[model samples]
Target: MSEPLPWYKHFWPWFIVVLLLGVIIKSLVALNIAIDNADSLVSDDYYKEGKAINMDLRKIKQAKNLGMQFLVKVEEHQLIITQHGGPQYKAALQVSFIHPTLEDKDFNVNATADGTGAYRIALSNAITGPWNVRLEGFDNSWRIQQRVVINDDVEYWLN
Candidate 1:
């Protein structure tokens, strides 16, 4: 033993303590940085909008008593829009088609009324692949908009 450590001359104890504190501080800083990065990745508004789309998809598949399902011919894609409710409707129904690949191409079809609140709309060579059909209507102060995806491979039936 060369010499005993004194109160102010002991370097080993202070070094070990400083090292431990540095490690703890580094870990805390890393955790805070990770949390901040995750929050910047996605917006709250966009997350809510995505949830709305999921809910719309679920409601469309469960809808009953709409109208006859006709083959949407490319040359004469006829969409028969039928409204089932009491009394005559004053508002005009809007029919829009959204293409999966080309999102900007929006086709608006005017629904033709056929007595007893039933309507029909014809679209020509709109889109080829799968599509999301959106049916929108107004009930008093409430706005009802239903979405249904139509694909070539998928078949959905109320079972």
Candidate 2:
């Protein structure tokens, strides 16, 4: 009879080894992805933040009582905001752009009104996707927040 082949030289052992290696490599890749892209939407201090909701609502109420309205538009890299019926705010407006999922992508811009409630500021880059925007007075006495999706051609109304 012909000599039998050694286990290391056999086809079955090599096939089984390759399958295990593939699973191991795939698991390593998945682990790397999970570590790098951890979730950022949850707040660490849930109790404190929850208690602060009423304060935020009070600010919104102040804005509403003052009849504040904003018309927001994005033109190229410029963000244009016009106040409709707010007080003659002497201080600059602070517009916050909060990314829905990624905290690093959030930013703020300050724009001075042109004596006619018209304000403009240059954005660092083009922004897309969903966002939570907060428009606050310079002293933070009044504020309004809303969720908006960025589109180059769309106009947003905030109150």
Candidate 3:
């Protein structure tokens, strides 16, 4: 038999090299993806956030103690709120619509008293998605918030 060909001429060696190169390339692509899509929900100030959460819990408790209940309605281009049960809230309501992922889509609507315990606000844009609605008084003493999916439904109850 002729002298064995060099190792570089063998099919198995070339196949191994190709697989190793493929793995290296795939790993580089994964590294690039990892760097691009880093976790963003991690807060830098954990202690401060924890303390603030306690404060929010207190505010929520206050709202519950006051027996605040609201019925939010979406009518075409206007949002209507009725405090069906409460101590007759007279203050203007500050409603916050928070998007779970997109910060740019987050907005706030200031609803003024329509009549009696009812409030109304004109929506500047049509909003349809999963949103966190935070209902708070103008003075910001208490807050009621919940995750809701806004669709064609006309009425939503917040307790």
Top-lDDT structure, candidate number: 2
Error of 3 at 116 (Å): 7.9
How high is the lDDT of residue 28 in model 3? 100
User: For candidate 1, lDDT tens digit of each residue in 1-159?
Assistant: 688768667888889989999999999999999886664334569978899777765544433333323223233354555444423354665556766455456676655567655566655643445565554433322123423455433432211
User: Which of candidates 1 and 3 reaches a greater TM-score?
Assistant: 3
Off by over 4 Å in 3: 1-3, 75-78, 99-105, 113-130
Clashing pairs in 1: none
TM-score against truth, every candidate: 0.38, 0.85, 0.75
Best-to-worst TM-score order: 2, 3, 1
Candidates' C-alpha lDDT:
0.52, 0.88, 0.86
The predictions' CA RMSDs to the true structure, in order, are 10.9, 2.2, 3.0
lDDT, candidate 2, 29-137, per-residue tens: 9999999998888789999998899889999999999989898997778888887777767678888999977889989888798766688888878887799989999
Cα lDDT tens digits, model 3, 33-135, are 9998887767899999999999988888888999988998877777788887768888788899899987778888787886565787777777788999999
